[model samples]
Target chain A: MKTIFIGAGNVAWHLAMLFFKNKNVQITHIWSRNKENAELLKDKLDKNIEIYHSLDSLDFSKTDADLAILSIADGAFESVLSKLILPKNCILAHTSGAQPMEILKLANYNSIKNIGVFYPLQTFSKAKEVDFSSIPFCIEANNKEIEEKLTSLANQFSQKVFQVSSKDRSILHVAAVFVCNFSNYLWTISETILKEKNLPFDMMKPLLEETLQKALEINPSNAQTGPAIRNDEKVIEKHLNMIEEMNLNSNFSRIYKLMTESIQQK
Target chain B: MKTIFIGAGNVAWHLAMLFFKNKNVQITHIWSRNKENAELLKDKLDKNIEIYHSLDSLDFSKTDADLAILSIADGAFESVLSKLILPKNCILAHTSGAQPMEILKLANYNSIKNIGVFYPLQTFSKAKEVDFSSIPFCIEANNKEIEEKLTSLANQFSQKVFQVSSKDRSILHVAAVFVCNFSNYLWTISETILKEKNLPFDMMKPLLEETLQKALEINPSNAQTGPAIRNDEKVIEKHLNMIEEMNLNSNFSRIYKLMTESIQQK
Candidate 1:
């Protein structure tokens, strides 16, 4: 199917590459307000793909395409969808994990018949290309026919595609924030601590890998480890003392003690 | 040279199994206060290795072992070392990361002409066996001769032997607590938050893997990701509210805010 990707951000870039990888789906046009970024990505693509400056500048009303992918930031979907001047029947989809399909409701895009969600539930970095096989795509559409079409398109890139409801996607997204956003923050916390000690972050890498492997092996509940659960007051005290000496972020000691107490609640 | 494993703790069990994997070392005996645990590990061994319940109970002083690896608890080491009567010049090593070699000097064990440390700088759970070949063994010896023998013995089990002074080892241990122990606590905090929000930790695995992989590929200072680091105050507020709802350890708010602030500083 002929397609157009609507952003030059991480997710847009990676998904565009995935679509490009499949000889079946053609990413005909790429758009970003920052034309340079769009052009940079276009340089990596097959010559057949066109590059555009922005959705506002694209003449979607006259363009003939099977589908248009909206991979822009959240809360900006309305503005882009309003700007698209496509026919009422052309498929339109936005890839926001937290936002619902209703966000794309448009009687006419100049009149697009279908609006759907193609939420790929993974964090993507513009600088770092990601593998889609491991990413779960959450699909939702205003209509069944559109959902089926979206699912087929999603399956072209990823191994798994789920027809998820808005509520479920929201749950999934909130969970992603905890797992991805907050978990990355945990690494930030480690980096802060290690830097204070003049220690290399490499020292933490093996342990981090092992922790991920173990958490996957067992139930996260059962997989939990450390002095907090064991209620080892001795080590906890020592750690708090060290935290003080490091003169770290003020919250570290309190967090350590709070977690120690939380886990100690037998 | 014949060798005896004098403890059945995490370190002892793991080291003994690895030593037996080597053809040069003889794991003649596995001694521990918990005889059942020792026997349990011994049964995992292919050969008929001996298991002794106590220091005096083992009559293997007559065995003329070249080295005795005192892998017991720190509190138990001095007494055990004092009791073990090896040949007057037998090499002795302890596996405690924090405890100094001077503890062995005080015991005055007859065979202890040499005192050294063979501290494997990694966390080992009793149930899980570690692949020592990849582990970094940090060694410190009283003299050059002892360092050479310890290096050779350590190399048999591991690819990397860091000739670390006790001072460096102590710093490494402190750094380890920051990574392993502190990181585990973060996992607990994240898990508790997830459980309260009716989410499964399974979803976090991909994010966890990606986060670790990114840190390895990029400098951690540049690898920072999350609301705090991004200065996304709205999401931070939402998370802080979520933490308040779960009563997810007071540390979560402080840690959450502090981490974000630290990243902002960077």
Candidate 2:
């Protein structure tokens, strides 16, 4: 199996690396807006690798790929899809959990016959390394052929693979935002709170690890503690008084109230 | 120092075991509304250990030499604080992040000038064992003498101790809700999404653990990922369509947008 990667961000870079590691698979081409990033894969792998700075310069038929994989931002997927000119039978795949395959079935998919999604349901950072085997890849397709090909590709990189419906993937992405992105936002808030107190976040890390570790061992509903669930109005009142020491007002207050109300629902 | 543990929930149970393990301290009493829970602690420790459903059963003045530490829920803390009868000049403390020392003021002092907090900032589940040594215990007091006494008590359980202001501890508790409780809520949502998709959440656990592990090594702002932060509207639209299929309304939808907007702000 041969793959041509699009984009050079965290997912692109990591996915590209995984493809390079597979003995049977060949990573034939990579294209990114930043030439530096585009060459990153070419420089790290075999010297004969093809690098394209823009989709316009590429001859899709000559790229010699079984698939053209999109690993760019969600907003950018359409632009690349609109401009791509691939062989009639080549598979066009994007690694986005939130994007459904119907988006690829537009009137513009002139030459490409097979289109699908190869979304990985996890957060990825460029500086940090990802173990592809550990990440869940959500694969989807408009037809069985594309689905089978994408499933095979996904299996090469990870043992955890699923042919999730677009509806399920969309809901999964929403839930992913809550679990991965929004949760990180909460961590950001925690770090800021600790910083204002002249307290290092390191002190809270072990507590943070234990918090996650506990949830892994028990249901989150069972793991819940703190003023909100306990309905410690006195303590909640005290904490609010202290937070007023800061000059900022944000949706944070609304979030706290809403979540508290939610926790209290039971 | 000989001590009396005033509750036997997750926190108290884990703590009693730790204190019992330490050669320096003895847990003389464990109070629990659940007699079985109290008996379980007694079963695991010295047979002479006293189990009480209420503080009224123990004449606190003659009970122990060092301290009477309360580790119940917040609403229960003040009631026990008001009712406890203790030795003159003995340290009386409660393990709560948000409660102020003033609750133990002139009423329950027993002529003992010492009163404080020995709060471990983490979530605890009864079924899951916790490594108390790594958990950070925040200590606050009415005065330096109480601070010293509470610090010694905290040191018996955890190596990391901080002399935090009640203001800081309260803020820390608020922050703890974000990092611990809110994080677990995210996991719950993830599990819900997976259940809807007929996918195993076990597939996502390794990634979830990796997400948390990376969080400890890097700031969450830098660790941010997903379609929203990447500003991938096509992907977002696709996910939205999927959500409609699942019949989930706009509550989580608004949260998705709100959190995405917040992530972009970072």
User: Quick one: best lDDT, which candidate?
Assistant: 2
Q: Which stretches of candidate 2 lie over 4 Å from their true place?
A: A107-110, A142-148, B33-37, B141-153, B234-251
The sequence of per-residue lDDT tens digits that candidate 2 reaches over residues B1-266 is 78888788777887788788888887777778778999998898889888888656645677655877778787776566666777777677777776776676744554667788888887777688888778888888888888887788778778898888876777777778778876776677667666777766666666668788778888765677766676766666665665566764444555556666666666
DockQ of each: 0.31, 0.61
TM-score between candidate 2 and the true structure: 0.90
Q: Write the per-residue lDDT of candidate 2 for residues A53-107, one digit (tens) a residue.
A: 8758555765557888887776676667777777767788888776677877642
Local distance difference test scores for all models: 0.70, 0.74
lDDT of 1 by residue, A106-147 (tens): 425447778898988877776665677767788998889999
Model 2 lDDT, residue A170, Cα? 69
The residue pairs that clash in candidate 1, if any, are A87-A111, A87-A112, A88-A111, A88-A112, A88-A113, A89-A113, A108-A111, A109-A112
Rate residue A118 of model 2 by lDDT: 92
TM-score of chain B in each prediction: 0.87, 0.90
